[model samples]
Target chain A: MTFQLIVFYSFAAWLIFSALMVITSKNSVKAALFLVLTFASAAAIWLLLEAEFLALSLIVVYVGAVMVLLLFVVMMLDIDYAALRQGFVNKLPIAIVTSLAFFGLLYYFITHGEFGPQNYANPAPKGADYSNIKELGRILYTDYFIAFETAAVILLVAIIAAIALTFRGRKHRKAQVISKQLEANKKNRLKIVSMEASIEETENSGEQEPSTAEEKS
Target chain B: MTSSVNFSIISAEIFLLVALCVIMIVDLFQRDKERKLTFLLTQLSLVSLFVMGAQDLGLERQVGYSEHWIKDQFSTVLKLAIYLGTFVALLYARPFIRERNLMRGEYYLLTLFSVLGMMIMVSANSLLVVYLGLELLSLSLYALVALQRDSNIASESAVKYFVMGGLASGFLLYGISLVYGMTGTIIISEIASYLSANQANLMIQFGLVFIVVGIAFKFGAAPFHMWLPDIYHGSPSSITAYISSVPKIAAFGMAFRILESSFGEADIHWTPMIMICAMLSIVLGNIVALVQTNLKRMLSYSAIAHIGYFLLGLSIGNDEAYSASMFYIIVYALMTIAGFGIIIFMSSENKDYQQISDLRGMGRFHPWYALMFTLIMVSMAGIPPFIGFWPKLEIFRLLIADGQVLAAVVAIAFSVIGLVYYLKVVKEMFFVDCEDSPKVSNSRSLKIALSINCMLLLVFGLMPDSIYQYCISAFASLN
Candidate 1:
């Protein structure tokens, strides 16, 4: 009846439709795209619920960053879409049974007894400056501070560990050993000789005298 | 803005943040040339955290930051256990990390961060705090599971964990919002008070069920435990040890805070649900674990069963049950750490030592390590004269006291079933012989740390009264 209710229902319906499509779509890429739609519509619902920060984050993080990456990866991979669908017939019975059971349970839960509609006395106006982002930030920095830090540390560790694990050393090849290189010295390669020149001159003079005597004979 | 800051309430966070920054700096400048220095710094930080947690042991329950968080004896004890457990895990991880050339600043930093998250989860007094802590733990784990990036198995496990973990978080947040809408409050204590005054509200009950499902999933209870085996088997053995031991303590702490602190008034609704989950987890965990060939995967399922036992204590929904659960978590953590430590010791860079056959001839080749591992396995199986026995005894005693004989019997039967799989590990270690012996090598530090860890299990098994008394006092404060 109200404009707000109309908008809410529209987004909610779209969300449900998209989610269903995500499950039922035969093509993997179509299913992924449907999931993106579901995420967007859910963000709209979050906005209606006055969780603006969460709604924006859902769009920015899930749809913008994560989904885009997923789309790229999915597109790049050489997957057999038809092969995946082959099991659909075999799984149909189980799927239908599960859906029916879930629906029945949900119906029982909702209709078996009346959960009195919660009424707050003098409820605040729908948009009475409720900034979810600000409150979330405050809560996170104060009460949930330890958890926030821990998350950062965990991420850091994962990054480091990933790099370390991947950075394998080259397997046993005959590369020059550092110890062998360091052990090499000038004494091992070169020898300074002072008597070598005098011995060479004496050998040359004896050779010349022998040749001269031979020629005179 | 300044009024929002509560130094005492956020002291644990501050300590961890400072420690993380200091470790980061030390890691950057300290150079890998002096690896011992980095190790010393890490150990020092962890020990100081343990001491800080110990100091808060006798403190009265105090709410800070507008009742968004509370610190009490139960949290303090659990935090102490987690810190100590993580410290021991880190000590065990060090040798393995070095051997695999995986030693880096991030590993220690991430571990410290994960511990910090556990501390927050233990002390959380609000759903928002709970979610924050849970996400912190979950995100860290996603990365930690994928820490060994070169291993395809690790990457696959990480992807599975990430997807499932995101879904679980979404469930938790939605449940929180639903409860918030029904109660008009996000603070857990307020929600409990509101629910007490307004019982039989179907919406509130529905929200509570969703929350419990989320919690159960986080604990890797049945029907939501698909990720545990893959993650455990895929991660490095040391990380698996860390994952199996420390997070369970955090999970228990979270369950206590949510089930008891917030939903105490909704006992009629939640208790039955928890009982069903507990029974399911026990039956499913034990039955499925019987067929697992991978040691890590088997241990993962066994951990699920242990959670069921812990839940049995929780489902009793009394002070005695709470203490019993706490006791169970502590002992379970120790036994799991010791068991996984042996695996880490046996694992090499190329080999994971995850399969039962990998441990064959361990008794003949490395008799002492095998003996210690056997002791750990027997204790894990809940055999007598080990620390694991006390938690089981406590849980059964509480169950009997609470007049739940059938559930207690079920728990005991599952415990026996659990022992079968654990004994398979022992069987492989001792009875089975290998034609080619695989040598087991460990550093002196690792040997010393593991000796202390296993020795403490025996010591505590013999003398559980001291810890039991402490748990009693903690629960008394809770009441």
Candidate 2:
């Protein structure tokens, strides 16, 4: 009946509905749109859970970046929704059974579980001046320094990997072979010749060559 | 800032990182002339790292960086193996990469980065550190697999490896989060304490399943090994050699840290799942490998079977078995490097030597190369008086000693099934004849390195006690 409870229920409903729509929607684009909706609702739920930093990251990382990528891929591929859905009906029964069983298990655990108030109590609400990002950064840089550095290394590796995998050199472009340059020497690259000239033969040959060039011209 | 960071504990890693950056910059400026320099620098860095790691071989355990990492006798032993394995792999790969014009700076740089990742993983004492190190290694490997951009198969394999690797990472991260949730800590020592106190937690059991799945995928055990063959076959043999050696040692390090240290208390629960996976992997890896004509793919399957054998040690769930597993993985890494080294040495620019048929008349034409390959294959087949026999024998010895008779029997049976393919390689080398004889590697260094590598296998086979005692002492230090 309270406002927070109402907000939670509505967001929870929208999250579930959008998630189901993401899978069941016949159109791929629509499914992507529904996935966006699902992510947004999940972020809102995370907000309700007082994980403000996580909520914002979900929106920024998942919705802003990843969803756009998914949309681009879906639009570009021109995938046939009909073909994709061909076996859906045949696989539906087992899917339904598995999901229903999962749901039952979840429900049982949630309602009748050993995890209670003692193990997990509601965290105290933060003050208006508290900054989740600041607190997170403080712990991350200090206590978890190695983990932070490892993450940086992982991201660097990822960037290098992406470049290595996709970037092929263009052909027919003038490229330098440094080894060749390093190996080059005057003896190999150029020749200087000195010879005693046979003046009469040189003159006759030069004259014949010019006359042939003139005839061709 | 809880404790002052011990810079010396990670000195080798620091040295490698600095060398990596320096090489990258040098390569960038030198442009066309940087290939050989980069290769030399990478080798230099690895040698220095080996020296650095060797210096601390008998040092007392040092836990630093907020206990997220540790350097002990165990880690030092494994780090030396990684460095040595990688050095040999790169040495053998030089001729192959040079012939194929795949000698780019990125090839060597990415490998160094992955080596750094492996070092980190080997020393990790926290789940968070383990995950990050794994990601670093996986990302680098994905790139290395696709270094041959002109080949569509390489690109396809890269994509497949990336996606599957991402999925395995997700599984691993989820499991870590679950374990964190249950234990309220991420440190391995703390997690072990918590697990001992709360052994009945179903959530911990769930987390263990996911962790095992991730480990299985990394080890390329059955049911999670779909990407292994395709990646191995599609990758250039040079990259294949590097990957097949260093990564297995790193994975063993990770298994030791995560499973043996963090979740040791819940062995009864995890042992059964691991046993089933081991059995399936052995049966599947051997039987399927029997039909593979592509040498690389056959080796990948054999690698999987070896993984199953490695897991046999873990299945026994004791300290001796753990050490046996460590010894097994180290020996396996060496065997794979030598096997792939021959393949690289035989391959030329135009002829890839990808098929068993390509190896025809190798023995007749080049008896020395054939002799080396024969030693490698015989060792892999687990015949007596070879390095491979000792590890298998060690596994069986530990299993039978632990009263795991059925598991030992099944393992021995599968190993026999596995020997057929290794023998196939030998037979192809010795018996079969082809009209065209391929050119062998002209690099003297590669030939010499390979001879030493294979010779070590025999020498180690004869003197297994020294290394076996080293493994035992390292494990003993763990307690």
Candidate 3:
């Protein structure tokens, strides 16, 4: 029991530290990375509480997908890190005071509330399956089935509606029709007119050019 | 098995689903040019739903699988009000959708689905049912807000709505899990009974707080209401009309279910929390609305203030208080519909008159519509001779009767603060002058509908006894 308390407190302290780092870090990328750590620690706490499914999904979905996307977007943006740092000094006093007051209230609430160590301990097992994933699926499918289906349908309609709104005809541009290209074969391309040059016309052109050249000379 | 599944309990939801399917099939086969037919069918479905709800007046029944659905007068009254609000909003939405060339069928389908959600929510007897209903309403709203696909603001609003909604749902689900863990039950009545027997559980108290947070967020209470103004501003005027009215009724229903049914035994824990939320929402919602330039955003803030009033009733936690909240939601929904309907009428396809300045000289060009809007605004301000007055008066009376004198005082103060913003819209409509005068052209059907909606507010305001009596009886039956 002592060991478990030690582990839980360590994880909680790590979470709070990383969360604070996420806000106060000078570098944006570092801040995002710290946020990922904070999420990981929180998930660990969830795991400690026997919510394995939620903890794993949180790590995989939020940490893996969402944070990665956020990192990429943040990296792509043209942000002035120095300018961001300049505002910190001006804002630090108020930020510190507010956060301290917030943490103080939160601490008071947690410590003074009825949820003390005695209440936090797990109760005796009731010998029933309370697996998070299993119960979630059962409730979702049986009781909340209508709503689940409605959400799916709403998303489907949103997808189709978005596609329809964006797709438009390009009517004004002159483009090669695929059907016309398909109809044209090697025979149409190879058909060329062969012209024979007339000798008398060629001689007259040559003589007129020479006379003009002599006059100029 | 089939005999156990009582059809009457879920008749309203089943009827709405059937109507939605018919609307969808009609829209699918019909051509785009036949938009008017789609609108007609949508209006017909909503009206029929309203009629079905009205048919069960004062009738007490329980239905659905394992009696997890209820069809008492309370549910019927709420469902009736929601259907009426949806019907009016759809009528107002038609011209806007037609002018924008948006997909009419899908819009109507989503609206129908949202109304169905509200019905399920109000009638829900189980936590699972309540969650399902809330999600249905929320998901439909997300898509509805983004219906104007080409608009960046609409897409952003949809995203904001999605994130906030997702967070609120998480809070609600966590709370549900906690409560389930403590009581081993999800049915509201069962949980209430369990908590009544085992009121010493700390887990139950924590769970109740989390659940109330989720409910407070839905009601647009302060500190959790950052999404409300952005969504109201970003969505189209017609969609805003829908968002500001019916969903609030659903929120009230959910609050009633959670506080009165599930956590009534733990009133010592919840009442004080609700009191805090009520005070903050009232103060913040009113004060923030005072400086708003956009009418929709201002109204959104005003909605938060009104929610504070509703919460006052819930905090009182009495039979009269419950009925007063019910009456308040009905009147609030009507007044909001009338207000947004006027905005819809004035808004043209080429221009959106969302800015308060755009409403300048509107009283001169459209005197009757302007008068109707003024009546709604006044009612919204809680003035007498309007429906809004009765709800406030009833709530205050119930609060005072419950010995919550201080809460009653705070509510009255917030009502005055709310009046300042509502009067701002009125001032813009009547007094402001513009070089280019506003000209509103409405279809004959819409004109008649708007007039009727406004006149009912006045009529109900004068003779609120019947509705008030009905709500009181409904609460009595529940207890």
Candidate 4:
């Protein structure tokens, strides 16, 4: 029990530290990395709570995929850190005050209210063969189907919204009509010139050679 | 209160989902730039939804899908109202969107999707469902606001809306989390039962505070309303017309469901915060509206004021007040749609008439439209003989009946104070003189739609009880 307690306290502390770093890091890439650490520690905490499914999904989805993409984007972008921090000092007081108030309230409740191990006992441990995914799926599909479907629709809206807002069709694009291209029989596209074999035309052949090469490439 | 699985309770929702998918695909194959086919299909679906909801109004109130979705008269009435409001809004917005070159297939699709979102919200029986529905609605509106990509103002407003909406969602999720922790449940009816059995805890109180703040933010009650006027003014007038009217009703539904259905037994802790938001919205909305020159912006403030009245009714914490608030929101939605429809009518393809002064000589130039506009403005001002007056009177009467006479009188005085701005628009349309009139939209369909909308104010005003009873009956059956 003491060993488990030590492990939990360490992971919990690490989670809080990394979460703070995620917000306070100066470099974007560093912040993104800190976020990954934050998620990892959170997953550890969830595992300690016996929510193995949530812990695994959190690692697989957020840290493995989302954080990697975030890191790539953060590393690639040319962000102006100074400009981003221009109003940080001015806003710090209120931000600090608001967060402090929230923390104080949360802390008070954790200590004085209907929280802690005295009022709320730990959840019972499951059997070794328990399937977290199966249990989750049973309740999620049967009980929360409406919420699940609504969430699916929200994702659909996001897709529609992204495409609708960004997809401006090219109005003036010049392109070959495939039908017209397919209909070409060399009857109209190609014409034989009988009087073009002059000295000047032959001298201009060098420039045309590169143009034809460009088209071939 | 978990029940056997019954998908049939959500027959209307299922139909809407299938119809929207069909609409989305049908929109892709449509060749017309105006998307006439998609528009017709969308309206037809809404009408059918209205019918379905009306039929459901007589059915037994049941919490289906394991208490995750509800089918009750309250949700039914709200859904029917949403359907009717969207139908009118889309019709009125057609010319406006067409003229602005925003007749994309996605426009209709997103609006319908948002309607689905609202339908879900009005009937949501769980916090999870509420959050999902709210996100769907918010996401669609953000995209719709930013539909005009070329307009910098629209993009700005969309970002503002997205950020504020994200914050509001964050607050709500936090509150829901805390509530779940305290009560060990997320279902609405179950939460009420749990809350009634449990003692008041600081965590739950904090959670309820966060939830109330989130609701007030969604409702655009002041202190959380800094984002409203800008978003309304920045969105294309048609988008503005649609967003301003319909979502308020759905937000009311979601709030009522959560606060009353889930936290009704614990209203004592939340009502004070609601009353504060109500008072702040009233004072701030009215005084600020009086100074606004932009008519769209002014109407946005007026919307804020109307929100105050409804929130006041809500804070009263009684069935009668709830019904009155419901009636007020329905009336408010109808009037605002017509009011913005006038803005749509006055502006031509090349120009937008948004300034209050732009209505100069409208009465002289277009007598018929001007008359309808007058009725709309008069009704909005709560003048007797118009529909808006009855709802406000009902709210005020209920407030007095509940022994909050001072607040009722104060609310009435401010609404009367709100009269100055509504009448200002009226005076601009009539009293001001001009040599020539600006070219207005000549869409006969819009004209017909606006005429119908304005006539409703008079029709319902002369006999407010016709609609009031439906609202009364809706709350009569609420648990």
Q: DockQ values for all predictions?
A: 0.15, 0.46, 0.10, 0.45
Interface RMSD values for the candidates, listed in order?
A: 4.7, 1.7, 4.3, 2.4
For model 1, what is the error of residue B317's alpha carbon versus the real structure, in angstroms, after optimal superposition?
0.8
Higher-DockQ candidate of 1 and 4: 4
* Candidate 1: residue pairs that collide: none
Docking class of 2: acceptable
* Per-prediction tally of clashes: 0, 0, 0, 0
Q: Which tens-of-lDDT digit does each residue in A111-196 have in candidate 1? A: 55442323324445556776788889987777656445556655665565566446555788777767558968999878887664
User: Which candidate has the top score in lDDT?
Assistant: 4
Name the DockQ score for candidate 1.
0.15
i-RMS of candidate 3: 4.3
Worst lDDT 10-window in candidate 2 chain B = B27-36
In model 1, state the lDDT of residue B275. Answer: 89
Error of 1 at A213 (Å): 47
Q: Which has the higher lDDT value, candidate number 3 or candidate number 4?
A: 4
Q: Which residue pairs clash in candidate 4?
A: none
Name every residue pair that clashes in candidate 3: none
lDDT (tens digit, per residue) of candidate 3 on B10-126: 766777777777777787688555476778888887787777677788786565565466677778888877887888888777777767756467788888888878887888888
Candidate lDDT scores, in order, read 0.81, 0.87, 0.81, 0.90
Error of 3 at B298 (Å): 2.0
Candidate 3 regions exceeding 4 Å error are A1-217, B1-3, B432-435
Query: Which digits, one per residue and each the tens of the lDDT, describe model 1 over residues B100-146?
Result: 64576667877777787787788888887787787777766776777
